[model samples]
Target: MVTLLTGLCCALAMAPKWALPKILAAQDASTESLGQAPADDPRLAAVRRTMEPFGPIESIRVPGGDTTESLVVGHPGHRAELEVLARELPGATAAITELWGPDWAQSALVVIAATPSEFAALVRVGAEMPTEVAAASVADPFVRGNEPTGQRVVFSPDAGRRLSADGLGTLLRHELTHIAARAETADGAPQWMLEGFAEYAAHRGRGHRFAEIAPTVNAALRTGTLPEDLPPDTAFTGGSAVASYEQAWSASTFVAEKYDEHRLVELYRRLAAQRQDAASEDRVLREVLGIGRADFVADWRGWLSAQAV
Candidate 1:
């Protein structure tokens, strides 16, 4: 069986429900009929309280046509919050459905339940998560939307237990980046680039630049640990996986900074076009950047060494 692993919403008349009901009774009627007060629940209350300073809460909904009774929280920064959330969590389906202005959505969204106390809400997000993608274990393992529907975010149990804004934002960025590119490049793309792209996007939004870590990567290269070429499937054993990802992230950051964002997309597109993955990627890089692998590596090393120490 062909395994299709991506965060894009597969178009279907029905959105397969993503829930493992531990607390919610299976017999409870559909959300369309039983939409309850979000304020009653502690989680929803917390969400509401956090959002209260900005505006009132509004209804949250899922693609399944279920509406969540919520308070609409509208304020200046809320819109940016949603957009940032949307950008950072690209794997989830999200939309600023009601845009009052450039940065404002009519309501601050807390989907699946009227309140956070609903265990099923968390379960539902978990259920929608694409299990095929492997990421580090995080609290409330969630994803941001990647498709036109908006950001599709998944919040695992851990997200609620000890949620810190910084950590949540990082997680949001990582998973959402998954949502953004999940549909475009899954078929023949390299996993290292896949993750590297997401990692780069996540950190970049947070003002963290890979250039800051170039020295570390350069040191690895000097030790002969860095592969002359990007690591390939045959080389993807456990020994190389972690290091390969770091290198790929470094290379991706370098490309984005030295070249441009479109160039990164073009590089992936070219790589996907060729049947041979690594060779295809190299060809694309050489064609676009006009540098051979050896020269590119040497230049990259020198560039790393010259960065602001």
Candidate 2:
């Protein structure tokens, strides 16, 4: 099995249901049916080819997105999951655009697997797909200056079983943000910034209270376990993963609150453009946020401390 993990949508998913504002829920009544993928739909080919063996494939057109197309796909057993993603598509796209702007393809493919084998095929992870991972965003390789191709969000077979409708909705937003920002993200970029930015985007404007969004960090802060530095890449995958995700999210949240959403995005663009050492990172932090690396950490720590109460 493939063991290499991809970027963008890897973390614990636990968020309460958020009532969609009326306008966002306008399409809810429309997803009652799903149709077979037409043989000529090129976009469906990406996942449909691999997913067909699991069962007969069914799909629904997402109501609102970029001029191109967006779809949610799955087999019969995954009808409910497919409908949930289809319903969430427009709102999730709007939320991502509200923050990520209109630079991306905006069009996407969301696939729900019926079994672990199907899940691994969709995500293409060589090793067994990790059970804890609920979804991932991937794209066919593209040049630095152009739009990405073959972009899709694949959900594990167990995602719907493990996550509630609203949970899947939050996860959809989380992964879509990754898809939206993939053009700006580079390999070897700092994991803290990458995951933190995604986390911030995921929970932004959802009316989630701080403690609810970051239970691990809140507990650590109240117990006097303040993070002195940003989480390292390894921290995203093991026993420390959940707390690291919370701390990372807090860092991005602090930047967005203390400065503004634009600068938080600007910081992500500059820092994630390529690999950086401490000195280079310090330079970019100062350039974007008008603070050195140490000061950035201090401010983030202070932000976390304030949220403890």
What lDDT score belongs to each candidate, Candidate 1 first? Answer: 0.40, 0.76
After superposing all C-alphas onto the true structure, candidate 1 shows an RMSD in angstroms of: 13.2
- Clash number for every model? 45, 5
lDDT of 2: 0.76
Q: Score residue 49 of candidate 2 by CA lDDT.
A: 78
Best by lDDT: 2
Give candidate 1's total backbone clashes: 45
Candidate 1 residues 1-309, lDDT tens each? 011232221110101111111121123233343233345644355344434543454432222113322221223323323222322222222321111011212222332222332222332333433322222211122243422222234333223223333344454444445444433444546655665665565455455434332334545655554456655543333455445555666666777788877676566555543344545555766997877666766765555445433
Best by TM-score: 2
Q: Please provide TM-scores, in order, for all candidate models, with all chains considered together.
A: 0.48, 0.90
Q: Give me the runs in candidate 2 sitting further than 4 Å from their true place.
A: 1-9, 14-37, 143-145
Q: lDDT value for candidate 1?
A: 0.40
